[model samples]
Target chain A: MKTLRLLYMAEVKLSVREMSSVIFGILLPVGLMGLMGMFADTQLELIRAFAAIATIGLVSTGIMSLPLSLSSYREKKVLKRYKVTPISPTHLLAAHVLHCFSLSTLSMVLVFLVAWLGFGLEIVGSLWLFLGGYVFVMIAIHSIGMLVASVSPREKTTGAISSALFFPMFLLSGATIPLTILPEFMQTLAQIFPLTHGITILTDIATINEFNTVSFLILFVLTGICLMISVKTFKWE
Target chain B: MGEVIRVSGLTKRFGQKIAVQDLHLSVRAGSIFGLLGSNGAGKSTTIDCMLGTERADAGEIRILGTDPRANRRSLFQHVGVQFQESAFQSGLKVREICEITHSLYENPIDWQKTVAEFELSDKLKTTISDLSGGERQKLCILLAMMGRPKVIFLDELTTGLDPVARRDIWQTLLRLKQTGVTLFLTSHYMDEVEKLCDEILVIKGGKELIRGTAADVVHRTDSENMDEAFVKLVEEGIR
Candidate 1:
């Protein structure tokens, strides 16, 4: 669609024009993974470790940082200008969502490449499963980001709320500490957040042959719910 | 002439504060209409309601003979707007903003003409972050003009600009009117309302205080200028 193209171009231009976000979102993950891989004891350990690192990068970029930037733009009244034009609200939202998702995806690929080439890691499953899990996580997290942006009154508030929401998910999702090490209660609690299911899917793709359909389905449902709430709650003013 | 916009019994409330109350007005096609009120006078609220950006609790709005509430997309093509506090991507240049806006319309105006007329040719490559207040205002006006809508809404359009910049924009607005573009602009400047508007709507505390031609308001009140007439009307209340 012509509208889609315009939205894509706008997103690309806005992101690429200022290289800082790209550095933070795309290159930062790869750099962190490379450093960790160097210190990693073995190829298997490095591959196992990458799930957490990538999750951190993706969550920060897609959930916290991108939403803060957008809400700040709204607080500055930048988004109000679009209201007058023929461009619809859906187009603007789609562009921002695509921008964050693509950058986060690129970061994922870069980190995986480093893990594969630099550390000689092996993925035991179909590449499609890895890609699918990656896409699912990105959409689900991006939807949460939109919900954050929709409710945050100001950019500063967006930053605060995003961090508060993300850090607990980051630590408890079996990404950093394996679920096997956690107590029974904590392990049960982890299932409430999408990151738990998402990391489970990602690790399954990397360490095993088949995808975790239960985890994948749960994540897909969560993504849909977040997206609907985001659309319903978004305020233009 | 056709009625371009009609509002009857429009009211908007945010929690306990009513932003607009029983607002009624009509803007004829191909004419300049001004909304005059001081700060917190509900000028922006009224404009937002008409644009369907703010949902009114009670009322009817017919823009181009269709309900703006239910037919925003169709009405959007016929209406252009610039809000009171507008911002842009600081990295965007004036030329790019114009180009992007031009794409939104089915039949857009010439970007070349827009740039030349707005005197933005020299700043084509200038990023918005580096632009001064007047330059940003110029860009905003240019963005509004690109679509050549049948009606344009400008809220506090000249609040920050210097006199020279304001005059330039006024001239450009007049030129646009020559092409049969109806304008709905809001400002606190009485002289601006008197000079540019064929009819003025004075609002106070979220309601219509007075509506008539500049000369009619002035002559009816025996005031020397529109400002005095406005002050008298607000103080005495609309009888």
Candidate 2:
């Protein structure tokens, strides 16, 4: 736990010091949240129609931000440096996932605040359940990010790959569109992704207390499988 | 006495090109060992194998009397490695790098004293990215020496440094020898091998051409200088 804290502090300081990433990772998320809030009244009907739009934070950090961070570290040999040291890969990987988790949580809070203050949105769900589902979604999507980073040829290519994977997940996960109105094939394809299950369950419990045991089980299985594969396939150098 | 490093019948092949072939060596504690080879002669490959960064095709390697294949993390705790390139986060300060490395080892050298010895006290807070080539090399040595390691591996240690820095590092290596640390170093600079190494292994075409003390190898070639001796041995092999 102490080692995890040390690694987290190191990664956070390094990330904060890098201005370009800071702009995208921190400022951009806040800006996008604000942009959504600015039109929340007209969009409130649309957003509240499918409350999963609130999970844009999870997708941004997990699918886009985290992969780029890991890929960049690989390119810079930070991961390789850790390989030569006494640090275990599991600890390092845990630190990375924890860092992404914290960042995504922060982004979610910002978006929630904007929605509440601007659009008079109300979160009617159990806070603990929302947090659990949020963390699971972060872990599952961050696992995909690690998989992409491991396969990317270079850090420069991470952005293109992550962006390519990000938009579809965000749109189809009910962040930008309502899954209820989509065709059955699209919804089924989206269900294979954790974002759909995560947002669906999180919004259901938060707004209506409509818990689906099947969706929760699907999330657990997907998270378990991806976490195993990411841990097995991740390469430092 | 523990064997610091051992390799037997180690081979590395890159597609059709054989980098190292049928290599066998044992370095004992408290001795300075050298892997002398010219460009692309597979010195780095052998070092990589011992470091457990790359696997040997057909041989066994034990670092510090433990199989590196099985106990990489356990052995790594007592080993310090300096690569040829400036292989560090350049944006990090020298002091920060030292502190971070110290955290990794069970017993680390005093950072202030280490920096003073390297004449790097003035550059403690300076970012590695802003350092000169010689300064960066000194920083690398400083980091490698910080933990008072049992064994140190240096690959092409003086490649891109000025003469003064190279001489400073050689003097430091001699000091480290007095403290009874095993040193396994690879270099194309024959002069460096002659000055610092207690024993040298000359490798060419992925095989050992000769292995002996500096004086013994020079005497065998009937050459006054180590450079001329190396050339004579290589030329003889060509014939």
Maximum-DockQ candidate = 1
Q: Candidate 1's residue-wise lDDT over B1-239, tens digit each?
A: 99998999999998999988998999999999998877888988888889877889999998889877687766778788888776665576666666667778887888887778677788988887777777778777777876668888888888988899888778878888898999999987788888899999888889887789999999888899998998888787742
* Residues A125-180 of candidate 2: C-alpha lDDT, one tens digit per residue: 67677777677666767777877877787877989999888888867877666676
Docking class of 1: acceptable
Residue A211 lDDT, candidate 1, scale 0-100:
78
Instruction: Report the number of clashing residue pairs per model.
Output: 0, 1
Q: List TM-scores for all candidates, in order.
A: 0.90, 0.85
Which tens-of-lDDT digit does each residue in B127-235 have in candidate 2? Answer: 8888887778778777777667889888888888778878888888888888988999987677888888888888887899988898898898888978888888877
Q: Residue B56 in candidate 1 has what lDDT?
A: 90
- Give the alpha-carbon lDDT of every model: 0.78, 0.75
TM (chain A), candidate 2: 0.78
List per-model TM-scores for chain B: 0.94, 0.94
Worst 10 residues of 2 chain A by lDDT: A42-51
* Cα misplacement distance, residue A217 of candidate 2 (Å): 5.5
Residue A224's lDDT within candidate 1 is 86
